[model samples]
Target: MLTYVCFLVIISVSGGNAAIHSLMYTYLATSGIEDVPEFMTVGFLDGVPLVYYDSNIYRVIPRQKWMNMAVESDYWDKETQISIRFQELYKININTAKERFNQTEGVHTYQVMYGCEWDDETNDTNGFHQEGFDGVDLLSLDLKEMRFISLVPEGIPTQNKWNNDSAWLENLRFYFSDLCIGWLKKYLQYGWSSLKKTVSPQVFLLQKDPSSPVTCQATGFYPIGVTITWLKNGQNHHKDVVLGELLPNEDGTFQKSSTLTVAPYELKKNNYSCVVEHQSKTFTEHLTEDEIRAIHENYLPNSTIVGVVAAVLLLVIICCTAYMVYQKKIESESCSDTTRRPKETNPSVLFLGETMLLAF
Candidate 1:
């Protein structure tokens, strides 16, 4: 299994009146590994991990708040059983793969990623199923031909066997065309409130010193779609620019970075800026004294300071709100029966309504 995996979300989700969304699951089985799980799986929706299960965990666990709905609805139990089946199946698959490679003992992996993508705008759907051994493709599904195709020479026999099974072919057809799409749509419906919301990125420019590269970082973005580029003189980008991968934040938002490498002499003569495009908004940060932040003195950036202050303020507000509610509750208890307080409405239900997935 890859160490820093975000799952193989084959299709990137695009935004519009009706955007493209994808649901993918990756199953990985490792051979002769003591520190890691023997089998694991991750499920992604629109490039975000919604659920995960490892041999050690032994049960499916929800990763997002919206995913808790599955637990409340008892879907997680069914999923856990399915994952257990895959855990056993993939172990055998990995052993077969090792035998095919003529290896007796070693650390290796057998991986599979399968999913379906739907364009809500056009009502079009696409499905994919790919398997790999030791990070190289071994077999892939060919939907048009209704068969599994071998990607490597060793996979030919397995591909032929899978293709010759008429019942398996029919099941595959129904799964990709109907079952997968139905499940994807149902998940979308269940989590649309959280998935549809978008948060603008907070951009920052950081540098260690004058000779160091200037990194323009954008954080707190949602939807997992963003572009970061360096511009020179408001037009083309600087000669040396490195774009980083999109990563998830602890708060479920996303972050990305673009770095500009230039000499100090070049910095004074030309104007370089970092431009970030997310959703329908554009943010630009220039390389200047006011924009650049220094970390040599162990000082935090303005963004970090602001975030800390905001968090404190939010805590204060929540405390005040709770205190006020407590006061009101006391008044009610004095005026009416104390037992009635227990029957009062839950604050979470009142505020979150049906949006609350699970609190405990």
Candidate 2:
């Protein structure tokens, strides 16, 4: 159940103007867990899942159809081999982590999130790398400083050692600066036809009750970038409106909602409407007292604003969970085998560590 929520993923919409494309990978390894694999890895491109690997399957499987069609069987054959190698390394990682923390038992995890972003309009590229133990960041790579930094005192030793290793640092430099970016571009090129696809949004006006706020909902949209605004009698309105986060549908589309608080008396007198803007489309949902009667179809009665947000989050969040699919038992042991020697290391996979390095 270890979770890390530090990375603020700047997702992009494919058909939007000036989209920042990204490629990110998350690796999780566990110890002292049942019904969960010893290691798992998931890769994302522009917020869509691309590849998934786990100890249970001992294979690197594409999560999206485009990915499978774009890549060859030999590519998967090579990736499976690499993933199998990494699984052994991750087992050693878990064992080593327990020793560093001085914990003999209980479930613990090592997680890493590393990736790069490319701005299509500007051709600018950025890299990100970070790792933690048991859900807390222990070491994160700082490309600007060319160093590993530890926010907590306990991680200082490992940070200093990693920074001092020139060969390892140089490999990381190449890994992020060139290799990661190269891979991202290749994937984008391979999947351009599929990645550039877009689906228009469908808008709805909903009210939970006469006393509750009226909500404007936009669902079944692709690319994920959109805006919901309130218009009062043809003029832009901004008062007492709450916007929801972009949510993913099971079919790869997106959804969002915005709530407007207006008195029943005003609803009858004033013309209030919701405007949703997405790629090449503008959807306007006009609010009416008649729409209030439709509450039974789509509404959650929650007084507190926090509860409303939480309720919205709870509705589809669990179904969209990317993790929690692992299958196996884990050992309460030491850390991983030396990371494959940096030289001749494959660029397809790069796994950072909390307290250990593969070895230069």
Candidate 3:
């Protein structure tokens, strides 16, 4: 009974398509093959090889020999040994105990194979090998020049898993589904980070002219394998972008930058941001309308300061004039008093009525 259970487990594991596809991809990658195939609905495409998954770069290869060398140099599945054959070659039985390869000229093309399967001991040597289709030709591909393209796994979601106790299978399904989704999300994030580093070193923005719009500028680098953009409110800006030079770094990495003319209106408000796209991630430096205003906030005009000082001086003059007017009024009153002849009658008044006064 134990042996029978083990047999059933083996069959079940082998029959899982998802598990099988994962193993197949890993096996081919380690086989030192130059051309990495892209998975599609029908099969896989080997013409355009995947070079960097993070950058999503792929190159096309025309020949099969380069692919073979790449496979042999890399570590492949120890238990799996793949076979290949050209077109018009003889075919083998599908049910043969050992796994075999099939060569065809369909949309999905196989460049290499490596792996093994369970089979009978007596007929192990007579196992079926890979067979090919007719008129499928090989090209002389150069490994170095091949372009690399990024391929994203299909149907992968980015979400957390749910739990339900109504059915045991529901819980199992949620676990597996969420696991794949989480993996894909993390994988993409890591790839983007790596890609950003490879694209450029440093970038910045500056004012083109005091009167003109704010311009994005860079000192240490040129744009390559990356995009430079100016944004307003999370939208792409469609203005002329000025590109800078690619400067050398001590660490052997390249540096580049770009500049854009912020519209006069936008600059007035100071609502703008510069975005650098390397790989799938974006690095953004932003200035809000308030921020831009603040940059020049302290720079008051000389004329304005002078005007303010003049107004203050005028206020002081008015106050002084008022005080002068009050003093003049007091001085006029004092002068009038001094000029008035003391009533002239003080001494002479006695003599006037003397005759009548003598009788008294």
Candidate 4:
């Protein structure tokens, strides 16, 4: 078997709320003197054009733009040469995405990921690629056969015969397994290192409404394997506990929350606590009856507050407008009365005319 060094890179983009998630992979061989790095990218999104890129460029270039520019500009030739060489690879990515994401229709969540791998040895190279939904692998590739493969949660039928070819077998033996194994080892090493590094969690207890469950939220923790439990009077209360998934934070840490439901009487009578376990450390937080009552008393529901504020502002605006209108009406009435009232009779002028007539 020929020994080789290989590198694999995977990029994934995912979306939420009826959006499609995309996964792409590229492989490179670095062992032989003539080895050249190979690259590819694929994206799955509704109404978005297909995406593919090789070593010639780092950013994503749309297929339509590449095609149109290929004939118009000299730079197109250089930029598209690698793409032309990897046309089959691009097609595989597209087909795999279509099969996996159902043409990206009715998708609610999507993700984008980047992965790289390197091997040392005959200079053979392999790329291990996969795409999925909801943590389930949907499609992958058989690098040796240069064919698409289906994964769990949804399976596509395959009639590919190249796997049986002796040449394909030879390539698989020399390149594929070694590259995958090397990548897996690297991944495990990184994961182990991450687990060793820990950050304390910031925990809070909040209740939005009296009818809703009280939530114990823990955020900014590392390694993602943490548990939150509700305790009543020093005893675990599993019946009223609801655990949430570990969600990633913007800083590469994780957050999770657990909720506890209790009757109004129970809440008043019993002391409730939130207990957290992570990386061999345990944390306990007790919620006093007074504290719980304070949360309810001090907190005004956002929706209610918003509605009340909006209504009050609207009322003030309406009252001001009505006052202005009434003032204008009063002013107009006063002016009209002044204009309509008959002028007082000029008694001095009448007497002066009578006296002048008598003198004449």
Best by lDDT: 2
Residues 172-195, model 2: lDDT tens digits: 665666666666778888767656
Question: How far is 332's C-alpha from truth in model 3 (Å)?
Answer: 99
Mark the regions of model 1 whose C-alpha exceeds 4 Å error after superposition: 1-11, 14-18, 31-38, 70-72, 102-107, 289-291, 294-360
Q: Highest TM-score: which candidate?
A: 1
TM-score of 4: 0.43
> TM-score of each candidate?
0.72, 0.66, 0.23, 0.43
> lDDT of each prediction vs. the true structure?
0.61, 0.63, 0.26, 0.40
lDDT of 1 at 281: 81
Report the candidate with higher TM-score, 1 versus 2: 1
lDDT of 1 by residue, 257-337 (tens): 888889988888989888889885899888885457443344334433323212222222222221110000001111223
**Cα RMSD (Å) per model?**
15.7, 8.4, 48.0, 34.2
Q: Per-residue lDDT for 143 in model 3?
A: 15
Candidate 1, residue 291: the lDDT equals: 55
lDDT of 3 by residue, 219-304 (tens): 22211245567777778776676664332232212345566655566565645688877643567778555444454454322222
Task: Assess candidate 1 and give its lDDT.
Answer: 0.61
Candidate order by decreasing lDDT:
2, 1, 4, 3
Off by over 4 Å in 3: 1-200, 212-224, 245-247, 289-360
